[model samples]
Target: MSDLAHLPATQALKLFRTRALSPVELMTAVIERAEAVEPRVNALSETMFEQALEQARKAEHAYVHGEPRPLEGLPVATKDEQPIAGRRASDGSLAYAGHVADTTHPVVERVIAAGGIVHARTTTPEFCCAAYTHSRLWGITRNPWNLDYSPGGSSGGAGAALASGTATLATGSDIGGSIRLPAAATGTVGYKPPYGRVPAMSPYNLDHYCHDGPMARTVADCALLQNVIVGPHPADVVSIRPAVHVPERLGDVAGLRIAYSPDLGNWEIEPDVAANTRAVADALATAGAVVEQVEVPLRRADVMRAAFIHFGAIFGPMVAGVADAHRDELTPYALAFAEDSRAALARDGFLAGLELEGRIYAVIGDLLDRYDALICPTAGAAALPAGEDYVDTKLTVNGVQLDHYLEYSLTPVFNIAGRCPVLNVPSGLSSYGVPTGVQIVGRSYDDATVFRIGAAVERVLPWPTRPQL
Candidate 1:
C-alpha cells in the first residue's frame, strides 16, 4: 500500500501506459493510504473516492484502448479554495460552510481535462488568508513528518497530502509563500509561477501577488502539472498570453551565476533552516554553478507594510464580506488578518503600498540583474506546531526573536515583486524532524531558470521524497 500509494506520478503514468499498473489499483492504494493517515494528518477536507475510482477505471481503459492524456490515470488532490461548480467550497471557514461553487476554477478544469483524477480536495486557512492551516470549521491539519507540527498554509493540506502519500499530484496557490511554506514544512516540491503564468478566477487573477501553480513529490511532476494548468484562459483576462513552457528535462546550473541570501538582509533564520540552506548553496557550488552569498538590503517593516496595504484593500475586505454579520464565526487568524488589513488600509492607502512595492522590487530587480537566480530560505523557521495559532505571539529563530512570523519568511518580497518565479525545494530535515527548504528565485518571468536551478539542487542534494509514516 505504501509503495504503490507513494509511486511518483511520472512513474505511475509510465506503468499505466504499459498496462503493468492499473489506475484502479493505484487509486485504491492512495485512497486506503489517505484513509489510514487522515486521523493523524487531516490533510483532506472532503473525498470523492467512489467517483474517483469510477474515473480511474475509465482512465485505465483509455490507457488500454484509447489515447491517454498527460495525467491519465493519476490521482490529483485539488485545493479546496477553488470551486468545482456545485461542489461545496468552504474556504476553511464555518461562515460559508455549505456554500456551493457556481463555476469551476481554471486550475481544476485543466487538471480534469488532462485526465487527472481529483480524488479529494485539500484544506486551507480560513478564507485562504492566513499563513497556517486551522479553522473553526475543519479540525486542525498536522504535519505528516511530525504530527505535533504544521505542514504550512494556506495550501497546508496539499503539502500534507503529498507528503503522506495520499495524493500523487496536488494543485497549490501562492501569494506570500502559501505554497512554498507548506511545501518546505512537508518536504515536498512547490512552484510559485510568476504572476499571470496560470489563469485564475476573477479578482484574484487581477492581483499580481496571487499565483495558482503545482505541488508534487518531484520536480518533474510539478512541471508536468504546471504545463497543464498554465496557458491563457478565456475566463482570466490577466492570464499571460502565449504561455511559457517548462521543459521536462532542465539542464545543469553549471556556469550560471547564482546569488544566495541567508536572511534576505533582515530577519534572523533558525540555525536548522540556515544550515540546510547553506548545504544547498554548497551543493549548487559543487554542481559547477557560481554561488555567491550576497546581501539584499530590504527592511522587514516596509515589506509587511506594503503587503498589508495591498491585502487590506482586497483580501481583507473579501474576508470581511464573508464574515459580514458572521464575524464571530470566523477563525481567530482570519479575524486578525481582516482587522489588521483594515487598519493597514486605513493607515496607508493602496497607492502608498504600490509605491513601496516598486521600491522593494527595485532592490530585488537590481540584484537579480547580476545573477541567474537568487537562493534563500523559504521560511526563516523550519517547523510550526499544529493547532497553534500565533495570532498574538512571536517566535524565536537562532536565539533572536523576530518581530512577527511573517518577517521570518522571505516569500512576501517575491509576492511584492510578483513577476519573479520562486520554486521551493527541500534542503533537508530540521532538528525538529520537519522539513526545511530553499527558494530558487528567478528573474522576472524567467520561470525556466528557477526550475533549472531547482533541478540542479535536486540532483546534487537528493532528499527523501516522502517521510516514513
Candidate 2:
C-alpha cells in the first residue's frame, strides 16, 4: 500500500470511495506527519487528531454504505484565523492564545459539509497584520523546502503545508496577497477568487479587500474546493450570487489574449525575480497565448502609500488600545506602527489616502477593460531569511532601495482593484532554491479566465513535489 502522505486529496478520496483505503488509515498517516513536522515548521498551533479521527471513522462508515459527502474522509488544513468548532482559533496572537471557538466559521462549515476532515490550524502573523508568518504564539513557520527561509504569510502555514505534502488542500484568506504571497514564496498553487466569489466576513474592512480562498498543489484541486465553498451566503452580503461555472479541463493557452506586465509598469524588480518571471511570460507566448508586454500606468508610490495608510488607519487604533491595555505584551514594531498611525491621523493624512485609493482603482479598472488579463512577478524576490522581519531589512530591487517592505509591492494591486481573480503559479526557482511565481490577474468576475491562464502557465514550469520534512 502507498503511504497516505504520498496521496493527493483527490486520489485519497478515490481510494476511500473504492474501499481500498479506510479514512482511519489516512487519518493516521496525516497525524503522524503533523507530529513529525510540527516542531520544524511551527505550522500547526493546534492539531485536531482525536476529533479528526472520530470524523474519519464516521466518514469511513458512510463510504462503506456508499453515502459519502463531497469531501468525505479527505484530510485538510485550516488557517489559524478560521474558526473550527472546539478548536483554538488564534489569529497567531498571544492576546487570543488558547481561545477556543464555540461555533465554526461559515467557511469551515462549508468545507466540513463537503466531507473534508479538518485536522489542524496553521500559523499566521499576529492578527495576520504582517506578510511573514511568525507569531509569539506559534514562533515561526519556516519553508519546508529550506528551513533557513520563511514561508510567506499570513497564509504561510497553508503554503508550507501544501508544499511539504502535509496536506493535500488548505484554506487561506487573502486581504493583500496573504494567500498568493505565501504560495509564491513556498511553491504552492494559490487562488484569490474575485472579491465576492467566496463568503467572507472581515471584522477589519468590508469595502472590498478581504477574500477567503483555496490553496492547493494543483489548479484542479483548488477548483474542487472553490466549487464547494463558493456560492451566495447570507452571512456575506457581497458573496457572488450567480452560479459560477467550474472548468473541468483547462487545456492549452492557445488564442488567449494574455498581457504581461513585468513590474506592473512601475515598481523596481530584482534581476533574478525579473528573469524568472519573464521565463514564465515567454512560456505563455510559446504555448500560443498572444502575449504582449502591457503598460499599466500606475504610480507605485501612490498605491503603496495609500494601502499602508489605509491599513494603518484601520489597524492602528485597535492595536494601540490593545497595547495600552497590555503594554507589557505588545511587540515593539506593533507599538511603533500604532504611534506612527496616530501621528498620520493627526495630520489629516488618512483622508488623502482614501482619495488616492479611489484614483488608483479607477485607473486599474480602465486598464482591465482593454486587456483580458495582467501578469507580473508574485514577489520582488524569493523567500527572505526566516524569523527576521523583512520590514527592518534594506532590500534593494534594481540597485534602488525599496521604500516599503519589498513583499508588498507585487500584491495589493489586485487588493485595491478587488474585482479580479489572481493566482500564484510557480514560474521558476530562485538561486536560493526557493520558488518564484508569476501573478495572473483576470478581468472583473472572470475568475475562470485567471484559472485557465494560470493552469496553462503551470503546465510549462510546474512545481515539483517535496516530501514532508
Candidate 3:
C-alpha cells in the first residue's frame, strides 16, 4: 500500500490495465499517505476520501470489465483556489471561507471526465497572492524536504503533495510562477503552458499571463495529466481551438540550440542555485544540445513593476471589492495588496506595465528566434521560512537585498511574455535538502519544445519522486 502511494500515474495505469493493481487499493494507499503527511504539511484544504473510494470502486469495475477510461482511478489533488462545484473554494481567504462553488472550473471538469478522482483539494496563500504558501485560512504548507521551509506558493500544496507521496498527480495554476516556483522547491515537475493552452475560469482566463497546468514527479507523468486537462472548452472564450497534445515520449534534445542565462540580466542568485543552473546547462551540452550562456536584456525591477501593475489592475481590484465589504476579516498582506493596488492603479501604473511588457518581449522574442529554447534558474534562492510574511519579509541573495519577497522569483518575466511555454525541472538539491530547478522557456506557443528539453533533462538527471517523509 505504501509503495502504491508512490507509483507514478503512467506506471500505475500499466498495473491497472494488467489487473495487477486495483483502483481501490491505490486510493486507500493515497488516503493513508495523505493522513500521515497532512498534519505536518497542511497541504490539503479539504479531503474527499469517501467520495474518492466510491469513484475508485467504479474504476475498479471498469478495469475488470475492460472498459477503463483515461486516468481511470488515478488520485488527483486539486488546488483549493479552483472551483469544484458544491465544494468549498475558499481560495485561502476568510472573506469566502464559507463560499461553495456553484460551477466547477474547466480544468477540474476535465479531470473528472477523464476518470481522475479528486481525493483532496490542496492549500494556497490568501487569494494566492503571495509566493510562499502560508495563509490565515489554511495555515502553512511546509516542504517535504525541509519542513521548516515553504513548499512554494500559490500552488504550494499541490507541489507538497507530489513531493510527500500524498497524491499521484495534482493541478496547478501559474500567474507569476505559482506552479513553477513550488515545483522547483519540491523537486517536482510543473508546466506553465502557453496562454489559453488549457481552459480556465474567468475573469482570470482572459488575463494573458495566467495558466493552469499539471504537476507530477516525472515529466512524462506530467505530460499524461496534461493530455487529460488541456483542450478548448465552451466555458472559456480565450481557450485556443484545436488542442495540442504533448507526446509522452519526447525524444532526446540532440542538435538543438538552447540558451542559458544565469541572471536574466539583473537579479542576485544564491551560490547553490547558480551552480545547479550551470550544471544543467553543461549536462544539456553533453547531451548533444548546443547550450550557450547568453545575456538577456531584462532588469528585475522592470519585470517586477510590470507584474505589480497587472496584479494591481486586475487581481487587486477584484480583491479590493471583497475587502471593501469585509476589511477587518482579510489577511494583512491581502489588505495591503488591496490598498497598494489602489495607489498603483491611480498612478497610471497599468498602462505603463503594458508598455514595458512590449519592451521586455522585444528582447525575449529576438532570443527565441535565434535559439530553440532558453533556460534559467527558477528562483533566486531555495525555499524560505514556511511562515514568512510576503509584505514585511525581506530576502537577501548573495549579500544583496531583494526589493520584495517576490523579487527572488525569476518566473514573472516569462509571464510578461505570456505566449511562451515554460517547464520547471529539478536541477539539484541544495545543502538544506530542498531542490533547485531550471525553467525551459520555449518559443511562443511552441509547447512541445520546452517539454522535449525537460524530458532530456530528466533523463540525464533523474529526480526522486518523494522525499524521506
Candidate 4:
C-alpha cells in the first residue's frame, strides 16, 4: 500500500490498463498517506478524498467497461493559486477567506477534462508572492524531508505532498521560482514551460513572467501532466497555438552541447549548492553531453531590481490594491511585498524594467544560442525555515550576508527571460538532508530538448521518490 502511494503516474496507468491495479486502490492508499503525514507536513489547504474515491471508482468502471481517458484515474493536487469555480479561492489571504471563485482556471479545467482527479488543494504564500510558503489562512507548509525547513513556495504544498507520498502529481505556477524552488527543496521534478506553453488565468496569462506548469516525482510524470494541461484556451488570449508536445521517449543527450553556469557569475551560493551543481555537470559530461562551464555576465542586485520593477508594474499593483482595501487582514510578508513593490515601481519604473529584462534575456539568449541547454543551481541555499518570515531580514549565504533574502535563489532571471523552458531536477541532498537541484534551460519554444536533458540527468542521477516519512 505504501509503495502504491509513491508509484509514478505512468507506471500506475500501466497497471490500470492491465487491470492489475484498480483506481480505487491507488486513491485509497494516497488518501491514507495524506491522513498520516499531513499533520506533520501540513501541505494541503483542503482535501477532496470523498470525491476522489468516487472518481476513482468511475475510472475503474471506464477501464473495465469502456474507454479510459489519458489520465484515467490519477490523483492530482491542484494549486490553491488557481480557481475551480464554486471552490474557495482565498489567494492565501485572510481578506479573501470567504471569497469563492465562479470560474475554473484553464489548467484545472484541462486536468479534469483529461481525467485527472483533484484530491486536494495545495497551499501557497499570499498572492503567491514569497519564496516561502506560509499564510495566515493556511498556516505553514513544511518539507517532508526536514520539517524544520520549508518545501519552498509559492508551490510549497505541492512539493511537500509529492515528497511525502500524498500526491502522485501536482500543479504549480512560477513567477519567480515558485515551482523550481519547492522542487529543489523537496527532491521533486518541476517544469516551468515557456510562458505560453500552458494556458493560465487572464491578466497573468499576458504577463510573460508568469507560467503554470507541472510538478511530480519524475520527469516522465511531469511531462505526463504538462502534456495534459498545455494548449490554447479561448479565454486566454496569450496561450500558445498548436500546443507543444513532449515526446515520451526522450532518448538521450549523447551529442547535445550543454552549458553550465556555476554561480551565474555574481550571486553568492553556498558551498554545498555549488558542489551539487558541479556534480550534475559532471554527470551530464559522463553521459556524453558536452557540459562546458560558461560565465554569466550579470549581477544579482541588477537582476532583482528589474524583477521587482516588473513585479511592481504588474503583480505589485494587484497586491497593493488588495492591501489598500484590507490593511489589517493581510500577512506581514504580503504587506511588505506590496510596500516594496510600490517603492520599486517609483524608483525604476516600468520602462526601465523592460530594458533590464531585455538585457537579462540577451545574456540567456546568447548562451542558449551557443548551447542546447544551460545548467545551474535552482536555489543558492539548500533549505529555508518553514515558519520563519524573512520579510524584513537580509539572508546570508556562504557566510556572507546579503541585502535581501530573495537573493538566495537564482530563479528570477529565467522569469525575466520568459521564453525559455526550464526544468528542475534533483542534484543531491545536503548534509542536513534537504535536497538541492539544478535547472536545465532550453532555447525559446524548444521544450523537448530541456525534457530530453532532464531525462538524461534523471537516468544518471536518480532522485529518491519519497522522503523517509
Candidate 5:
C-alpha cells in the first residue's frame, strides 16, 4: 500500500486498465500515507477519506464496466484556497475556518467530473498570500524533503503532499511563485499555465496573474492532470476558447533555441542553485538543443514592486474587508500585507506597477521573439525555514540582504507578464537535501513549447519521483 501511494498517475492508470490496481486500493493507500505523514508535515487541512473511498469504489465499478473516465480512480489533493462545493474552504484564514463553499471552482469540478477522487484538501498560507505555508487556521505545512524547511506556498501543501507520496496528483494555484516555488523546493513538477488557460474562481479568474494548474511527481503526469483541468468554462469569463491539449509524450527539444539566465540580471543566487541551474542548461545543450547564457533586462525591485502593486490594488482590498470583520483573528502576516497594500494603493502604486510591467515585458517580449524558450533558477535560494514569514524574516542570498523574502523567487516576473506559460522542473538537490529547480518560460500563450523543453529536460536530468519521507 505504501508503495502504491507513490505510483505516478500515468502508471496507476495503466495498472487500472489492466485490473492490476483498484481505485479503492489506491485511495486507501493514499489515505493511509496521508495519515502517516500528516503529523510530521501537516500538509492537509481537511481529509475526505470516507468520501474518497466512496468515489474510489465507484471508479472501480467504472473500470470493471470498461467505462472509465479521463482521470478515473486517481486520488487528487485540492489546494485549500480553492472551493469544493459543500466542503470547508478555509483559505488558511481563521475567519473562513468554518466556511462552506456553495459551489466548486471550475477546475476542481473538472477534476471530479473526470473521475479524480478528492481525498484531501491541502493547507496554504493565510489568504494564500505568503511564499511559505503556515497559517493561523491550519498551522504550518512542512517540507517532506527536510522537515525543518518549508515546502513553499501558497500551493505549499500540494507540493508537500506530492513529495511525501500522500497524493497521486494535486492541484496548485500560482500567483507570484506559489506553484513553482514549492515544486522547486520539494523536487516536483508544477505548471503555471498562461492566464485563462485554466478556469479559476471568481475575482481571481479575471486577474491575469492568478492561475490554477497541475502539480505532480513527473512531467507526463502533470500534463495528464493539466489536460483534464484546462479548457473553456462558461462560468469564467476570461477562460480561453478551444483548449490546447498537451501530449502525453512531449518528445525531444533537439535543434530548439533555449536561453538560460543565471540571475535574471539582479538576483544573488546561492552557489548550489546557480550550479544546478547551469547544469540543467548544459543538459539541455547536450540534448541537442542550442542553449545560450543570456541576461534578461529585469531587476529584483521592478518584479517585486509590480507584484505587490497588483496584489494591493485587488487582493489587498478583498482581504482587508475580511480583516475588518475578524480583526483579532487574522494572521500577523495577513494584517501586515493589508496595511502595506493600503499604503501602496494610497500612492497610486497600481498604475506605477503597470508602467514598470510594460517596460519589463518589452524586454521579455524581445527575448522570446529571438529565442524559442527561456530558462532560469526558480528560487534564488533552495529553501527557507518552515515558519519563516515575509514580514519578520531577512532573506540573505550569498550574504547580501534581500529586500523581501520573495526576492529569491523569480516567478513573480511571469505573473506581471502573465500571458507566458512557465513550468518548474527539478534541477538537483542542495547540500541540505532540499531540491532546486529551474523555470522553463515560453512565449506568450505558447504552452506546448515550454512543456516540450521541460519534458526534454526531465528525460535528460531525471529526478526522484518521491521524497525521502
Candidate 6:
C-alpha cells in the first residue's frame, strides 16, 4: 500500500465537500508525506507547518459550515520564486537567499482567496535559470521516481513533490521550459498556458517567454487550479481576460489530427526515447486519433541562432552587475554564456529575434491550421543520474549525438512561439528505471484543447502508480 495516502485534488475535493475528511486530517497527512520524503528527494526548502495548520483549522470550519472555497482546504505547494508575504522568496541563489516578499504575488493571492492552503516553498534553480533544479541555498531536488536522477528545473521541487505525493498540487512557472521539463522528468502533468494567460509581474517583465501555470498528478486537478489562478490583473498588460470556460471534460480524439515528430524532424533524440514516444503515437492511433509523422518547419530554420539570441537577451542584463563579483561561484558554461551575451547581443538583436519568432510562430500556426495537435517526446533521455549537472554528449540514440542539454531541445520551442502546450504522459521507464514524458502541443489560446488531448492521452498511456523512490 502507498504509505502517504496518495490522493489527487479531485478526489480530495470530493471528500472535503462531503465532510468525509477534515482539513486538519488532510494537512497532517500531506505534511507527513513531505517530511517522509525530504531526506531522499530534497524537494522542499521550507515547510510552513504552523501557518498551514492554522489555515487548515479554518478550512475545516468552513467545510463544516458549508461555505467551501474553490480549493477549500486543499494542500498546495508553490515554487520558491512566488512571493509569499513573510516567507522567503529565495530564487535559490545566495544573492537573495534570505529575502522575503512584503506582499503575496498575484497568483499566490488568488490561490489563497480560492481556499488553498500553502505549506511549503519548493526548491528552484539559481535565479530560476538552470534546467536542473539545484542551488547553493537549497542544494538539489532529486526525482521522486529515482532519487539519483533530476526532477527537472527551475520548478523541479514542485514536480518532485507531486510525484512523491508530498502535496496534492503545486504551481510552476515556465520560461524556456521550466514547468514542462520538470513535469516530464517527474512523470507529472504540467501545462504552459498561452503567454499572459496567467498574469505575471516579473522584475524583468518576462512577458515574451515566461509563464506561471499549474502542475499536478492528474489533468482535472490541474484544470481546477488553473480555473482559480487565471484572469487579468491591472498591472499585467498581457493577462488574458478570464477564460470564458475552463474545460472539465476530456474530449474524444477520434477525429483529431495529431502531428507526430519523433525527433521534431531535425533535432537530436535518443533511440530509446524515440521508440518510447513512437509508442505513444501508436497508442493515440489506437485511441482513434489520426496520427501522421510531420517535419517541424522550424527544424529547418536557424533554431540555434534563434535560441541563443533569445536566451542572451534574458540573461544579458540579469547578470551584468554580478558577473565580476560572482564569476568564481557561477558555472563555467553560465559565465561563458553570460560573457557572450554581454559582448554581442543588443536591443536591436532582441527586437529582431522577437520579430523572427513571430514569423516562425506563423509557420506553426499554419501547421495547426491543418492539424489539431503535435506530439513528441518531452526529453531525449530519462532523468540524468544523481549529481550529474549535464547529460553527456556521447549518449547517442539511433546515430544521433545530443547537441545541447537533451531536456531543453524538446520543450523550449513552444516557449519561443508562445504556444499553450502540456507535457501530458510518461512514456514509461528506462532501463535505468527513471521516468520519461511526452509533449502535446496545441494552438495559441487553445489551452483547453491541449488539456483535452492530454487527458485522453493519459488514459491511453500506462501511467505508473508509484515511482520507485
- Tens digits of per-residue lDDT, candidate 3, 253-347, equal 99999999998998889999999999999989988999999999899988887787888888889889989898888888888877776776677
> What TM-score would each prediction reach against the true structure?
0.98, 0.93, 0.98, 0.99, 0.98, 0.93
Q: Please identify which of the two predictions, 1 or 6, would achieve the higher TM-score against the true structure.
A: 1
Candidate 4 weakest ten by summed lDDT: 386-395
What lDDT tens digits, residue by residue, belong to model 6 across residues 258-327? 9998876566676667788888899889889999998876662355456557777776557655557766
Q: What's the lDDT for all of these models? A: 0.91, 0.79, 0.90, 0.92, 0.90, 0.76
What are the per-residue Cα lDDT tens digits for candidate 1 across 333-369? 8888888889998998988999999999999999999
Error of 5 at 170 (Å): 0.5
| Total colliding residue pairs, candidate 6 | 2
Better of 1 and 4 by TM-score: 4
How many clashes would you count in candidate 3? Answer: 0
- Tens digits of per-residue lDDT for model 5 on 294-314? 988789987777777888888
Clash counts per candidate, in order, are: 0, 2, 0, 0, 0, 2
Q: Distance from true position, residue 96, model 1, in Å?
A: 0.3
Candidate 1 shows a clash count of: 0
- Candidate 2: list runs displaced more than 4 Å: 1-3, 243-245, 340-350, 390-392, 406-408, 467-469
Off by over 4 Å in 1: none
Shift of residue 235 alpha carbon in model 6, Å: 1.9
Question: How do the residues 1-469 of candidate 2 rate in per-residue lDDT, one tens digit apiece?
Answer: 2257647677777788889899999888877877777788777766778989999899999998989987888888988788877767656666666678886776788898899998887888877766788867778789987888889888999988887666768999987889998998888889888888888764632657788889988777778888888888777777778858568776777888777888876887777789988998898888888888878788777776676676667767777777788666655556665776676666658788778878887877877777777889988878767887654576666677766673345888888878788888887778878887789888888878888888787677666756335
Question: Residue 329 of model 1: what lDDT?
Answer: 88
Task: Show the colliding residue pairs in model 5.
Answer: none
| Residue range 292-395, candidate 4, lDDT tens digits | 99999989998899999988988989999999999999988888888898899898789998998899889888898899999999988998988877876677
